[model samples]
Target chain A: MGEVIVITSGKGGVGKTTSTANIGTGMAMMGKKVALIDTDIGLRNLDVVMGLENRIVYNLVDVVENNCRIKQALIKDKRYPNLYLLPSAQTKDKTAVTPEQMKKLTSELRNEFDYILLDCPAGIEQGFKNAIAGADRALVVTTPEVSAVRDADRIIGLLEANDINKTHLIVNRLRADMVKEGNMMSSDDVVEILAIDLIGIVPDDEHIVISANNGEPLAGSDCQAGQAYMNISKRILGENVPYLDLEVTKTFFQRFASIFKR
Target chain B: MGFLSNWFKSSESSSDIAKSRLKLAITSDRAVCSPELMEQMKNDIIKVISKYVDIDTKGLDIKVTRTELDDESGTVNAVLASIPIKDKRPFRG
Candidate 1:
């Protein structure tokens, strides 16, 4: 009985795909059989993020439409042998997949993989419903901005209404300097407003963009965002890992000194 | 003198303002009522009460908020309306 977690945010461009790619890769690096599903359908990008777009011969629509076997549609990651991506169909719309089909797909995947992560599209529409239909838990991603937090709150309410009660928050793209200057909401502030358990916070790092451009997830790397993703993965595996200390990025000496403490 | 004055100024941070605004917006959102709807409801209540007694519309305040339950089980969406009564209307009958 594997766990199926949905990565969702009601607003676009909040790093849902990036989190899904990194966390799935992070879990695979830890020796778990993980499958990442891009439920975005027409706006598919998870394959590109995972750098497996060139290897995709079949997609989610093909699998659901009985055009190919599930094994044929699964793409092996370039770096991790255990991580696989089920790419979405770029030509098909969100209406192509129903919640029942998603539930059945996840149930079948659950028998083989340790974790199945669904990268949901941005909205409270049919795609969101389909992604969460088979999920056992949810990780709501949001930035520290007002609009992102507002949409996060909306997503939380919808998740609860659908009875997916095991939900956690990941506040991404936090600027430590802005937070220190009282110009942006801290993670604590975000958690207080959303009234949910926080899983992790990824600092705003340029390395994240670089890794995304290269189609390589930063989870196993030594960058701050990479470390953050790795920590989030450990937490997902039921480890009692502490949150990443954002202030560690302030000084070179401190970053070097803290490595010894680890 | 500059530091002292700065300390006494008591200006709110931008994040603080954002927090308060989000709180207010979410409270109304969970209540399933927009700001316009809340205003309309307030006016209707004022009109109905005004026929029976003189009410101070200027002093009226209505807010949508969350209230903690008595048993501490969880909080619930609540509407808190404060209507000031000025005087009773004379009976025509």
Candidate 2:
């Protein structure tokens, strides 16, 4: 059976959808049959992020409601043969499906795929609960801002209370320059506060937005953030991979260029 | 000589300079205990103790501490607190 993983965050706009797409694509690139499930029912964006919006004829709700089969709803990625997406329904609310339905859907998909990545909706509401109900593990995504970290902490507490302890942290939209100037929180500070094992640190790369807009994930390229996502995918597969020094390389070059200009 | 003597006087309370006020605030916030309540409790303790013995109520100290719990057992591992009490005065036994 494939491993079911849920990518979630308590606060909105923390790049949960983006991480789901990139990591799913990353796993597919590594020759794993990966299925990315969008659980953000009403306000779905994973389809657009994955550039599969135009191909989504039948959605998750359709599959659950018996309007279509699971294979009919799954949109195969054009670039990666192993990657597939089960888009969420944009017209229906989250109540259209129950947690038991989600569990059944993932369990069925688990047999045919190597990894099942669920892109969870924001907030600790019904949508969030439904997203995580069928997962074997979870990835809590958060930004470095104080408010986001605080909300992420509350979500972590909730997850632990629910007995979902195989949780990992992904710090997204990190700005190294801001951290160096002490204007933003560093990865170390976030880890210290959240007290969870770090899985990935994706820099605030505008390329990620552009890639999502173009339906291409940065993980397919050699971009720093893309490389971070790839490394995280390996780590998820139980590989002892070291985290890349995303800030050091850029800062060192910047300092060297400044000295030369002087 | 005057400048050196002034430096010594200012440096006498180095503890006051090194201690952070925000750290104290965080400790209080984490424990959900207020400084005002702590002060009142200290006063009440001093009053009760003086009634039992001729103790120097001005020389007592009370503080609250926090501790972290064990990770595997999900138990609190550390305790952090602040306690306030009457200052201890060196005097008769």
Candidate 3:
């Protein structure tokens, strides 16, 4: 059966949708059949982020309401044959879909896909509840800000309270230069405060913004953030890929030399 | 004089301040005590202790906080309270 993982953050604008898109694409690039579900019903943006918004004829509510079959609502990404997206409904609110419906949908999806990723909405409300109902694991994304870290701690507590114990932390948007100058909190500091296992860290990169603007995810791109997402995907597939060193920007020669050491 | 004072002062980095503040905030968030429950608990404690001694009720301070264990194994959520006694009650035998 496929693993259903939910990417969630209690606060908005902390890279939950972006991480879901990249990780699902990264897994698909490794030849795994992946499905990305956007659970933010009223404020759906994963379709746009994945560049599949134009092809979304049917959405999550349509499938849940039995107005269309699951296959009809699933939008296949052209770049990756193995990747697909289940876009959210912009007209309907969070109350339109219940947790029981989400559970049934994800259980049905597990039979066909190798990995099912749920992009959760912000806050600890019904939207968050529906996204995590069928999830076997959770990835909590947070930046190096006080508000994000505080919300992350609350998310971890809520996850444990709900018995979703296999949760991991993803520290995103880390600035290594700021960390070196002691102006920003490092991933180590975040992990220590959150007291959870670190899966991966993505540094702040302009490429991420550019990819989002162009409606393309950073999969197989020669960027540090892209490499970090691919590393996270390999780790999810039970591969022991060491984390990319973001302490300093390495030259092409140095990176090439490190490949030989591996 | 401003430059000399600035050089003499030990400046704390903003990241360090953020870390310490976050740690403090999380510690309280994990303690999980409602304001009403805390107030009821304080009143209960004060009522029971008032029979033994005269305490300054307004001076009572109580809060749920995290602290390290004596054996240093790990930290735990502890209810720390400080109450002042104005006078001792007469012994009734």
What TM-score would every model get versus the actual structure?
A: 0.84, 0.77, 0.83
Q: Which candidate number maximizes TM-score? A: 1
Q: In model 1, what lDDT does residue A242 have? A: 84
lDDT leaderboard ranking: 3, 1, 2
**Which parts of model 2 are misplaced by more than 4 Å?**
A248-262, B1-68, B75-93
DockQ of each: 0.32, 0.08, 0.35
Model 3's interface RMSD: 11.5
Task: Report the lDDT tens digits of candidate 3 across residue range A1-262.
Answer: 9999999989999899999999999999999999999999999999989988889899999999999999999999979999999999999978999999999999999999999999999999999999999999999999999999999999988887787888899999999978976889999999999888899999899999999998899966899999999999989999999988897867999768755643
Q: State, as a TM-score between 0 and 1, how close model 3 is to the true structure.
A: 0.83
Tens digits of per-residue lDDT for model 1 on A230-260? 9999999999998777873458886566445
CAPRI verdict on model 3? Answer: acceptable
- Model 2 TM-score (2 dp): 0.77
Count of backbone clashes, every candidate in sequence: 0, 30, 0
lDDT for position A83 in model 2: 94
Higher-DockQ candidate of 2 and 3: 3
